[model samples]
Target: MRRVPGRPFEPEEYVLETNTILFRVFSTGGMVPRTVTDFNPGKGDRTRFAFFGDPTVPVLYAAESEEAAVCESILHDVPSGPGAVLYESFADRVCAPLAPTRDLSLVSLMGDGLFKLGTQARYVTGTMASQYTRTVRWAEAVHEAGFDGLVWMSNRRNTDRAFVFFGDRVEAGDLVALPGTGRIFAAGAGFDWLADYLTSLKIEILIP
Candidate 1:
């Protein structure tokens, strides 16, 4: 919380850091103040209880953000056609909680010199009027399900891609394997960075 020498500290400034991640708190403009637990402002009306290691707590309230517009398309912004704009007004908001997409522990779990090939499918929502309605109804379900954010895939038109509503709980290796689920393949924008990391390990991506 120490301010840099000679630099005026910003009142809205906040930061969270863990062993593997770091990001700044842009603003609480979209925070559900009533829903937030243990909110205590250090100063005038500003919450001082920031810097959370747990991804469940939102770090920023994304208002009219492109990320929000894209992820919340199921709410009614996508079908209008490509380049469809959403969140045009202040009524729309997306809470950006921090979450880990990649689990680096896999490096050790694989053992020395051992390599495995796996497919990673881009996560997308199912295409169906009923599905979109379900999505719209589930707008608040994310908070209920304890997800950081609704992670979207690359394709916007094809909503049929695999979409994980509760993606905040997702880890890097969740797709490749899990305790009881066995092997499966799914990718998300949050894990886009892993593509490069996986390639460094000699893993290849195949499109069918």
Candidate 2:
């Protein structure tokens, strides 16, 4: 599917999605109109409706009920790779920051929660390793420079670094929250703020 603007990466902690969606296609037989519809996540994952010109006598809809009469459906791409489908959502979670096309530094925070650097080389997310990036900037300062980052599993963006960017200002011990998993990744004026912000929101799915 094409990436939509408003779509959040995915929740870091726990991600869930339907295994498959229901689709319907109606034939008009030169009398009515044939309709096609796909199951979406909005207005609930399941639904039913009746519209005129439904030449097939039934309407098109997407739902999860066992009683649902479907014309056709495709299964969700369950990842067979090491860590693909293992997570709940789509691989786009890891795909985003790793998406080398982006402009930012993505460090790892590992399950142990420590600051670690990466070899992104800019403009390509082809990862050299599967380590989790941390948000805490220990030595580098983020106040003087603009910062951008997100949390894993959570789809929130942390712009809290604005306070540091505008002024040569910073408190001795100030803290900020990340998007996906609301965890305190790091503290420092040297590192970019967005890095911590993004490391927090982690959602991913593998496409095969």
Candidate 3:
């Protein structure tokens, strides 16, 4: 995956292909094309689409049936993207944050409620301990937001940081919500684990 560098490091174009079809997926501030025809590879091709709410996170798409509309672009990068089977609709009622909530506590919210991170948590177990670094400004932002320091899973306490960056403007304990989509952008391994914890409470998280 290519990372476009700037304030927000976004993944470069992800090209998806089928026997007779081609799809290019891009994440522009979380704004995904609304329909298949909205961004058809060509004038009269059958293309379908879907995306997540996170503006910076990379998204995925798949086609049920398609045929290659011969073009110069479709000939390359045909095997790089993920292969997904099309569904009439891919709504995740269990995890979709269809409604917003006032509660911002990471642990107190229930069943798809949005919340903020209370502190800068880290996943220090397995190989994750040595992976993912917080950019200098981002690290400063995490602390300035009054976040409690790093969090680790199990008994791992090592604070080795990698060059991987997280959302910069967002602070610790800040509510992670994707505007207009009724969902939250849960990034990093710690929040990923938090989503699992929420699942234990019968809450499904819409992590983009």
Indicate which candidate wins on TM-score: 1
* Ranked candidates, highest lDDT first: 1, 3, 2
lDDT of 3 by residue, 14-129 (tens): 11111222222121232343321122222222111111113421211212111111011121122223322112111211111111122211111111111132222321112231
Task: Give the local distance difference test score of model 1.
Answer: 0.26
C-alpha lDDT of residue 103 in model 1 = 35
Clashes of each: 3, 46, 9
Candidate 2 residue-wise lDDT, 54-143, digit = tens: 131121222222111110111122222232222212111110000111232312212211212221212111111121122112112221
Q: Write the per-residue lDDT of candidate 1 for residues 1-208, one digit (tens) a residue.
A: 1111112211111111122221111222444342211122222321111222234332222112333323333223334322322222212322233323343121100112011111111111333433332233222333343443332222332332112222233333332211221111134432353234334434333444
Task: State every prediction's TM-score relative to the real structure.
Answer: 0.24, 0.14, 0.15
Ranking by TM-score: 1, 3, 2
Regions more than 4 Å wrong, model 2: 1-125, 128-130, 133-144, 148-208
The lDDT of each candidate is 0.26, 0.19, 0.22
- Residue 188 alpha-carbon offset, candidate 2, angstroms: 45
Q: Report lDDT (Cα) of residue 89, candidate 3.
A: 15
Per-residue error (Å), model 2, residue 171: 19
